[model samples]
Target: MNNNNALLIIDMQQEDGFVLEHFDSTVNNIAALLDTARQQRVPVIYTRHINQADGSDMPRGEPRAADGGPSSYRAGTRQVEILERLAPRADELIVDKGRYSAFHRTDLDARLKALRVETLIVSGVLTDVCVLSSVLDAFALGYHVRLVSDACTTTTLAGHYSSLLIMANWVYALEILTCAQCLHALCDRAYVSLAPQQPDQFAHQPHELENTIARLHSHLVRTQE
Candidate 1:
């Protein structure tokens, strides 16, 4: 991976947000991505969604009310804590947010700029909500985005896939890949140089290139399933 790239794990907290299909698998994949980022010396940033003690900070008409109440993400509560499986190191950053997008009402953009990060590798929960929101904001902030499709999940399969498609189409042209492919592209020096551009140049012939593309397509489909 390039030094200018950072992994942004958004809202992977212990809240009711993770009660969805493939949640466990997504967590496991995110853990693997974290390990790869550490091995490659890439920076990792985590975001936790927390509201005020009295729920005054939550947005108007937010779904928190339907999910029991606005007290879910109360500060210092266990629901607002990041999952232990993908805990951040002492040196890593942990940005507390009150909204769906990590960049909203947070120093995320300033911190990434301070680190000279040009590309963000995004992974986390509620693919149709926080992940999508953050991805759009990152694009608008002039940062390239690479989403780990396998390392994110939503309340439903349709929501997850639709979010990915929307980000890739309407929001911005993001590089969407599975966690395994992302790890491979980041850790393998040769692959890193060819990926996101000139991937065909790495293949000798048309058949070889077709096969490579087919493999990646299959991986994406399987991850969604």
Candidate 2:
């Protein structure tokens, strides 16, 4: 536990382009995490996936609006704004990114370096996309990454868990915990995180998705002492 920890919320903008699994619950969990972070005086950083209003920064082969604008997270639109409930304060850092990874073509790394943030507590939408990309990049950039499982989601549960498994399998010292556990960890309380205990902790075939998810959930829950 240290003061070098920061919370990284990724792609939780108001874009309604896709329906996420457990979105409401995810938002609630993120809210809780935000509350704890602020109370703990931990730095909070938010990312907005804003594309060029004229579609100039749209990813290659991305779907386009009939009017030729970026389909989602259009710059200058409300959709590109962070959720009002979880909006950052004036002193917080807000990073606007045109790509999935917050570190991609953005000053996120530089800012984190300036803040001397060594660990990142990650949560947000599109778990398999932006969140996943951001977590991987964070790891590559030499920051300790912790994920709040319930605070992140994708269009489907399968995508969400699969991404978690992928990261757990390869992120090296990744720590995957639930929202409650994350809150406890922030407070320097006893909390459990499913860190890499062994190689391929979640290794499985595609058909083992359900079983793997069960195993993952097992790590996220607190058992009777």
Candidate 3:
């Protein structure tokens, strides 16, 4: 795994009205990715969407209930907390925002730069909303993005699939893969853990080892170039 890669888990919170399809499977896949990231010593970043207690930070002209009550994700409320199953470690970065994109009015870009994160492994809820927004912004900022298909879901299957297709085809050259594929790619790059026992056998063709490493790294990052 590249040392400059980071895992971004966006808005996996406990909001009441935000029901995702295949919630259990998505969470499990996210958890697996989280474990792999930690094992590879990659930075893990989490994003939470929270608004003001009085709904002052909510988007203006948003639709309201028949009673004219505003719908908001209040800060410090249980609804805004990250889901317990994929809780971030104390050492991980947790960025709170009031907008759909994690970079909007937030320090996510700076934080990722500080960690020297050249690639972002993205997974989270609402594939067509926050995930799509964040991925677009990340691409704009020149970060190679990998979207874990099984680790993300939306309220509707159509939304999820449509968003993935748009991202893969038009918005960006995103490397979309399953949790197992991602894990295997990460493990393959960890040379210390997966090194061959017979080092002397391949010493005559050192270029072969170099080429293998380069190919695997390229496969993982999937740069547009």
Candidate 4:
């Protein structure tokens, strides 16, 4: 995934917190990642899981509940709210899902295709379930997937770490990276874009301007040296 990519944060809602408490740390790192994406003008999409009442479980709906527990996670519920740590921008898109995969029963794929997004940086809860499902679908659809290893979690330590190992080994198109590495790649790309190329195109306006500014900085450095 290059600069023209988008970051997909899935099931990063309060409901998942009921199952995993480590979301606090993961969410903080995710906030940093989101901030970096915003600074680089990369699109960010947040997915919230919604469940209908029918004697379902907390997430997928099982068949044992008296007070309509499933409906508690419906759209706009406090549990489904995006965590405050990763504040979504006014223009950022938020998709509501009823199933494990964010793309299922959601316009996520169509929206990504419309934006010409080819690479997806996937991060979120239920590492073995939702995250894995979404990442696998992304690979099937030919989108390069980068999993933010630290920004995902499961209820238990084994489930969380094992998911990373599996994806790293078997997922060819998927790369496992930390938030910092991804941010560095984006920063490197920005520097590459600022470097001079096709001198004629920049010459008339600010070709000399770059050199002039560089020379002034060089002279100041010499004085200090």
* Higher-ranked by TM-score: 1 or 3: 1
Candidate 1: regions farther than 4 A off = 63-69, 189-219, 222-225
Q: Which regions of candidate 2 deviate over 4 angstroms?
A: 223-225
How far does residue 187 in candidate 1 sit from its true spot (Å)? 1.0
TM-score order, best first, reads 2, 1, 3, 4
Worst 10 residues of 3 by lDDT: 190-199
Off by over 4 Å in 4: 1-3, 16-21, 53-64, 68-72, 189-225
Tell me how many clashing residue pairs each candidate has.
Answer: 0, 0, 0, 4
Instruction: Output the number of the lDDT-best candidate.
Output: 2
Per-candidate RMSD vs. true structure? 7.1, 1.6, 11.6, 14.9
Residue pairs clashing, model 2: none
lDDT of 2 by residue, 40-60 (tens): 999999999888878887878
Q: Write the per-residue lDDT of candidate 4 for residues 87-136, one digit (tens) a residue.
A: 67799999988778888878999999988898898888889889988987
Tens-digit per-residue lDDT, 88-108, candidate 1: 899999999989999998999
Select the stronger candidate by lDDT from 1 and 4. 1
The ten-residue window of minimal lDDT in model 1 covers 190-199
Tell me, by TM-score, which candidate is best.
2
* Whole-model lDDT per candidate: 0.79, 0.88, 0.77, 0.70
Clashes of 1: 0
